[model samples]
Target chain A: MPDATEGSATRREELLAIAAGLFAEKGFKNTTVRDIADASGILSGSLYHHFDSKESMVDEILRTFQEELFGQYDAILASDAGPLDQLEQAVVVSFEAIDKHRDEVAIFQNEAAHLLTFERFGYLAERNEQSRDVWLTLLRNGIEAGVLRDDLDVELTYRFIRDTVWVAVSWYRPGGRRTHTEIARQYLSILLEGIHCA
Target chain B: MPDATEGSATRREELLAIAAGLFAEKGFKNTTVRDIADASGILSGSLYHHFDSKESMVDEILRTFQEELFGQYDAILASDAGPLDQLEQAVVVSFEAIDKHRDEVAIFQNEAAHLLTFERFGYLAERNEQSRDVWLTLLRNGIEAGVLRDDLDVELTYRFIRDTVWVAVSWYRPGGRRTHTEIARQYLSILLEGIHCA
Candidate 1:
């Protein structure tokens, strides 16, 4: 049998998952602690045992998600792979995030702007800058290595890549007809080779 | 001196512009007729002299914007331009829309899903289908003409194009450093020719 502490930890995680889903579907500002507790089939008082407030729940959710995502980016950046390979890996990792953490990705996309206004969420703004830096570094390296087009506007290119990949979360269903891998493959093809026929 | 009717018409247009900006900024659901009246520096009763309700104001705003935008798309589709030219022209027209009607573009992006649930906004859904059909037609024609790659997943390609182009409304400003034409050109270059150096 599982230890009582282990079972409680599992329950806490389950509650966070439920809260994350609600936060993603209903805007974070619109979701209440009671709603999360009700969704979990528990009393609001019981929820307080796991999380102090909805803000705490969301804070935990975003913090955990961003940490894991940035961790992957750091790994890709540190790898000895060529600049082109690193860029491709970065795109693959982003799509994987959308696939595995759909709710978290949506919450970040939809709520980060508003959430960043709070002192507690100041790190989100830094994460945004860090993300820009990652792409710019990959792009500049690619251009320097003579893999990416020399004439490309790095900023615009980064924005296009960023927008195209993340916005897929809006329409991309996890188990839908096209798997995220396939979607990433196709996007990479378009990004690496012109859609125009030779 | 302008006739009273012409003066009222200009004021009506000004009020709708203010309402659109608020709806874009605060979200359509959060914006109230009183807020619009306040923004216009007029009494709510005086505001209602032009529009029956907030819904009416939004309806007119969306209707006018979509009609003008879709009208341009129709012209491009009906033109004798080749499929490749047509695709490029369609993209150019879309960025132009973002530049010219930033508030309307944002309001539509942020509110269309919520607004579509109402009976009055039924046409928004149809407009969505029409947009899909427009892009698919362009892609199909390009494929048939041997200009675009035949192996492309037309639906996915369309989504990428649509997402990247329209999502620019989030960051695009009317008088930004780059003109809409320049942004469209760079985007088209990336879309048509892969960012990879030949």
Candidate 2:
């Protein structure tokens, strides 16, 4: 039997998961505590027992997601791999994040602008900067190593990669016909090699 | 000395331009006729004198933009250029569209889904399909000519191309550092040859 502390922790996770689904389906502004509770089959008071408000719940969701994701990028950058290998790993890990944390990814993509208006969610903007820094660093490393073309514009390339990867969440279904790994491989191939026949 | 009809036509164009800017920035649902009229230095009553409703204004804006854009695409497809040359021209013309009609592009990108719920915007969906057909035909034409890699996944490629080009509008400034032609050249070179040094 689980201890009381462990049991409540699991219950909290379950509640957060339910809340995330609602937040992802409905815009954050449109979702209320009552909506989360109704979907969770619980009373609103019970939800308040766990989270102070919907803001707290979404705050927790986005915070946890960004921490795990940026952590991976940090580790990849620190690794002893070549620049191209590191870049490939970053792309693969991003898709994995999309697959495993579909709701969190969607919420960030759809709701970050509104949330950033409040002081508490300022880190969302920081995360955007951090994301740019990571891509630029990787691209620069490749260019320096002469593995990637020196003429490539890192700024424009960064925007292309950023737009292509994140905007994909709009159409990507978790269980779609093509798996995330396959999509990543396909994208990386196109990025590394031209589409024209050699 | 201009005829009354020509003078009214120019004023109509100016009003629609102001309305498009508001719709793009504030969103279709958030923007009001009072706001557009205020922006135009007129009263809501006078604004309605020009257009029936905000809906009609957006309808005319999008219809005119798509007609001009798709007309260019149709002309490109019907030209005698080689398949590869035709594909490049389409990409160039698309970037040109983003350059010349930035507000309309943003309005279509941000508001298409919301407006689609109204039965009148159904053609936006068809225009999307037509856009896809144009890209696929160009890609297939390249593949059959043995200019592009046969192994390319045309559907996935179409999405990347679509996402990359349209999403650029979010960051593309009309007269910023790079011209749309320069950006188009950079993107096409990357798309055609990949970024890795051979």
Candidate 3:
């Protein structure tokens, strides 16, 4: 209840988390500010005291998640590791994001197109292009280093990897039988070695 | 348009195509019956004379597409080709569906969850389960034939294949730089053999 305190800041983060779950489960357009408030066991007026609108809550949710994610990607790309190692690390980091920030990932996957229409959320489009660049860079680096097949269609390869990895949010449960790391390992296995018996 | 004639049937097919495009682009809920009529250059009443509601158009659209798609899958399964060839053929057929019936595939991908809640669209859920079964059958058969790697996690492998193949519809444009067959061939190479330089 105190303003500018640690407890108040924690409360703000908790509220954003609840809003994200709603935005992910219900389409962002279908989820009203009241729904977020109701899910948080707070009133609309109280929710407004923390966020001016549901738009502000979503903006904060997506931006904060992306900042943390892209930072990790930057570190991986900047690391002294080999290109193949860097690519593996990037895949691991992506699955880790799915595990740690499932709701945020889901919201971004489902609502990005709708949200990107507004001027404020234009960065979402840029983030998409940036993601493409990250994958392309890793693939190209691997090829140049003789780690990946030179005959690869890097563009299509990037699309396949992006679609397979991110779309897992639809079926990947946090507490599923296989851990996210296991899933990533298996995907990497298939990505690196042919599935056929060699 | 003539009633009870070949022209009537052809006209009906034309109307359904227009409705599928709208439902795919604008979303099923966001698109109105009148919008289909407007896009078809006909009055709403004339459109109704051909179809009862937007629901009927979408139902026909999905059912027709699935019938053709599943029929091709059935033929593939029954063919005398080896398990590996069968699996490859299935991938080729799927890309062909995305190329030929892009709107139907997109509509199914985007609207299946919403439409599945309705009583009449229960088949959509069954079709999803059936599609999973088809892939599982193909994969399990491959392993039994000693073609696929035995250590491979078949279930996880199925998901990776399903997610990667169908999601291409989002970016796989018809008559683009790559034909559907070329895309399928390249994907098969990557799926069968890892992208790593050997």
Candidate 4:
């Protein structure tokens, strides 16, 4: 049996997941604490015991997801793989995150801009820069290594790849016909070679 | 010096532009005709003088934008350019539209899913299919021409390119230091050869 603090933490995690689903389906501004409470079948008072406010719950949610995501990115960056290999690993890992954390990804993508205005969510911007740095580092290394094309524009190229990979969260469903690995393979194929029929 | 009907049409255009900006900013479901009229500094009654309702205004805005955009697409499709050149032309034309019709593009990007529930906006889905066909045709032609890599997954490749190109509307500003053509050139370089230095 779980102790009181453990049970409380478990309950808190469960409630946050429910709130995230609601926030993702309905815009964060449109979703109320009452809606989340109602969805969780708990009184608003019970929710408050777990979270001081909705903002805190969302803050925790986004922070927790980013922590895990950036940890993976940090590992990829630290790996001794060649620059091109590291870039490929990064893309694959990103698709895997979308598959494994679709709801959290959706909520963050939809809400980050609106949420980041508050002082509590300043880390979102930092994570954005961190993500850019990870990609930019890999790209610059690839250029120096000659594995990637010399003529590519690093900043615009980063945005293209970043946007292309993350926007899939809007439509990608886990356990669908294509697994994350399959999607990553196709994406990398198109990225490496122009889609023309040589 | 404007005739009454011409003046009315000009007023209608201005109102539609205002409505598009609001719809893009606040979302269509959250925006009301009253909000639009208020933003335009006119009474709701005067708004109706130009537009029957907010629905009519949105319909007209979307219809006109789509007509013009599709006309350009059709011209590109029917042109005598090779597959690779056609692909480049299509990308340039798309960025041009993003530059010239930012508001309409924003509205379509943000509201197409929500708006498609109504009968009047069914063409949004059709337009999506039409867009897929346009890219697929170009991709297939490229394959037959032996200019592109044959191992690519054309459908996934099309989605990748489409998402990368269209999502720029979210962040792109027309008067930014980089012109749309420069952005297009940067994108073209990455799309063709990728971002490795060697």
Candidate achieving the largest TM-score: 3
Assign candidate 1 its CAPRI class.
Answer: medium
List ranges where model 3 is wrong by over 4 Å: A1-9, A42-49, B1-9, B42-53
Chain A, candidate 2, TM-score of 0.92
Q: What is the interface RMSD of candidate 4, in Å?
A: 2.6
For every model in order, the TM-score on chain A comes to 0.93, 0.92, 0.94, 0.93
lDDT of 4 by residue, A25-75 (tens): 676766788899999998878888888888898888888899999999999
On DockQ, who's better, 1 or 2? 1
- DockQ for candidate 1, please give it: 0.69
Give the per-residue Cα lDDT of candidate 4 at B11.
Answer: 64
**Residue A193 shift from truth in candidate 4, angstroms:** 2.7
Number of backbone collisions per candidate: 1, 2, 2, 10
Better of 3 and 4 by lDDT: 3
The list of candidate 1 runs beyond 4 A from truth reads: A1-9, A30-34, A43-52, B1-9, B30-34, B43-53
Evaluate fnat for each of the predicted models and list the values in order.
0.80, 0.73, 0.78, 0.60
Better of 3 and 4 by DockQ: 3
lDDT of 3 at B198: 75
Better of 1 and 2 by TM-score: 1
CAPRI docking class of candidate 2: medium
Fraction of native contacts, model 3 = 0.78
Clashes by residue pair, model 1:
A194-B194
State the weakest 10-residue window (summed lDDT) of model 3 chain A.
A1-10
